[model samples]
Target: MKKINPHTGILVALAVIACWFASLFFLLNWHFNWSNPLVYLMVFVQMHLYTGLFITAHDAMHGTISPNKKANNFIGYLVVFLYAGFFYNRLYAKHHQHHHHVHTEKDPDFAPHGFWKWYFSFMLNYVTIIQLVIMAIAYNLLKIWVDEKNLLLFWVLPSLLSTFQLFYFGTYLPHKGEHDNEYHSTTLQKNHFIAFITCYFFGYHLEHHQKPGMPWWQLYKVKE
Candidate 1:
């Protein structure tokens, strides 16, 4: 129901797509030669780009990318399918709402605590590259055993799941103050830098919390 800036969203979407295609070119070319360390390096770079693309897609879901709900939903789902492999819109919305409301608390969406300790608990409260690799392997193995189809289940599905998990956990956990309230500490500020790099500058959580209606490009200027 709320309006957003269409031009900003289109530009971001275009930028993400262009970067993704460029990265894909290098990744595909390098995929042919596993013996070369450069291939592995390119793979790592591509994976990060893949994650960043998903983050941009998240911007769409938040309606920060456009005023058109239909366009936002379509772009959001496409990113989910391409990056995360699932279509859990209801789940994403519900969890993200809680993430904005609770953020960094015990019940926060990104909390790595509780029974799911391995996935949730961490000092940095961010997913490690090693964890991602392990999850990728596990997801592929399960998909092969369950679906008997190797393609989507192996590569695409796991990537989607990981992206969703990252969105849920990364944004929800590590937030220290109540929503709409002033940020509580310097630690949060420092963490934002790390998040910025990992999430393509979506890590400016305090600014975002203050101005949920603003586009990502304009959120950096929000005062705490």
Candidate 2:
């Protein structure tokens, strides 16, 4: 409910951007023999790391990682364009705000309950390698058909949009109390852990949900 402070958000956003770009530069420049399996493995690892960084950026966008509105918007835009490749202005805000307010439920943004339900649901809900590949192919094919000047939209735009949706469903939805049947259990904790491992522990969901105003590093300071 409190207004986000811009100064803290800018600082955090800059740091996150620096880390993301640095990792990307390293991965792109690394000498990799496409013919070698190890090189392919390295590529896969780098991709996963990039995904994690992207997730961190998502937290920043929600202002859950920092209190800077400008910084949150800027970082959100950067993440969407540079990493995920979409440009959602109002929709991102609406979806994210609803997530914070509702946690999880029949909310279009959250996931429904069940163990296997959560697993398969989350996997399908999030932006995975398969989704990225399919998007890329679809974009190229669409460009060929549409003859559009901006070919990036076909893949990049959808990737960004889908990534944002995934962030909402995969992270926010599962942790919603309603979706969890009003019982916070180990499964929910594991969900947070999975998000942490996937996202470099960018402020666990429990911490963020409890204290949305805290910066990313300090989120863990909050106790349930």
Model number with the top TM-score: 1
lDDT of 2 by residue, 83-118 (tens): 644454644665565454553453334455654455
Candidate 2 regions exceeding 4 Å error are 1-8, 34-45, 64-68, 100-106, 113-196
* Residues 3-23 of candidate 1: C-alpha lDDT, one tens digit per residue: 444676878876876776676
Report, for every candidate in turn, its global Cα lDDT versus the true structure: 0.53, 0.50
Q: Clash pairs of candidate 2?
A: 4-67, 5-67, 5-68, 85-156, 104-176
How many angstroms is residue 73 displaced in model 2 relative to the true structure, after the best TM-score fit?
1.4
